[model samples]
Target: MSNVELTNMCMIYDRTNNRVLVQERVKSWKGIAFPGGHVEDGESIVESTIREIKEETGLTISELEPCGIIYRFNDQTGDKYFVFNYRTETFSGELLEETDEGRVFWINREELLELKLSDGFKERLPMFFDRKFSEGFGTWNEHNISELKFR
Candidate 1:
């Protein structure tokens, strides 16, 4: 059956020291992905990103700039998924002691790329690093990013 299986968002927070917020998801999928989660009912995309960051990292986002959107299509069933990508450098709050999702903390931008990351996130991390904003569509399996269409 056709359905929007999920709505999620990823955030890239530059702490001004070349560090960013990251989490290694343990409960669900395995890998280091940016701090984010599924969007709840009626919450706007931006709102969901903010809420997810706060819940998962104990950080209150003060500024969020939409960078792009990623649309994932299931290679097997043709189902679709959407993930909003955002970048921010302003926030307030102490880091959470721990999260059920995984360990949340700051890591150097260059060093973070060396860690094991989720497939989709691994492929999209460059976009965030380069600070390029665009819309993208790709297969969900490997996240073969076809091309980034800048808006």
Candidate 2:
């Protein structure tokens, strides 16, 4: 009857510098997450990214390039997570806590896997590094038989 609440997560990266931005979730979350939240009414996905970047990390993306869209499946059931991964070469702003999202940090690519990243982020991050920005989604394969098939 009603549309599920969708989230447009921002996965920021700078491959030339071998860097990416992530946030440490609060105790309840127990993992690191990309800086993003709900897409507000009267705002486009790009607008939401800009607003979220400012609110979460207090950074303004000077040059953002969309890398891809990802499906962050729910841990429980048929629900899904719609994420928009974007690349930014530069950001300028003071980091602050305007929302209850998490603690922000900018780490190099080599360090991402070491962090306690969100459940599906590991599966979705490679695309960004490959500079593959397009329409697509990633999902966990529940069975070995369908491992290579795209659902």
Candidate No. with top lDDT: 1
Clashes of each: 0, 1
Q: What is the alpha-carbon lDDT of model 2 when measured against the actual structure?
A: 0.67
Candidate 2 TM-score versus the reference: 0.74
Give the Cα lDDT of each candidate: 0.75, 0.67
Return the TM-score for candidate 1, rounded to 2 decimals. Answer: 0.83
Candidate 2 lDDT by residue in tens digits, 1-151: 2244455666666667777778887743357777877778888888888887888888888576777775544334555656666767677777664357778877888888998887556756655676643655444434421111112
C-alpha lDDT of residue 93 in model 1: 82
Instruction: Write out the backbone clash pairs for model 1.
Output: none
Model 2 lDDT-worst window of ten: 142-151
How does each model score on TM-score? Answer: 0.83, 0.74
Q: Name the candidate that leads on TM-score.
A: 1
Instruction: Rate residue 105 of model 1 by lDDT.
Output: 75
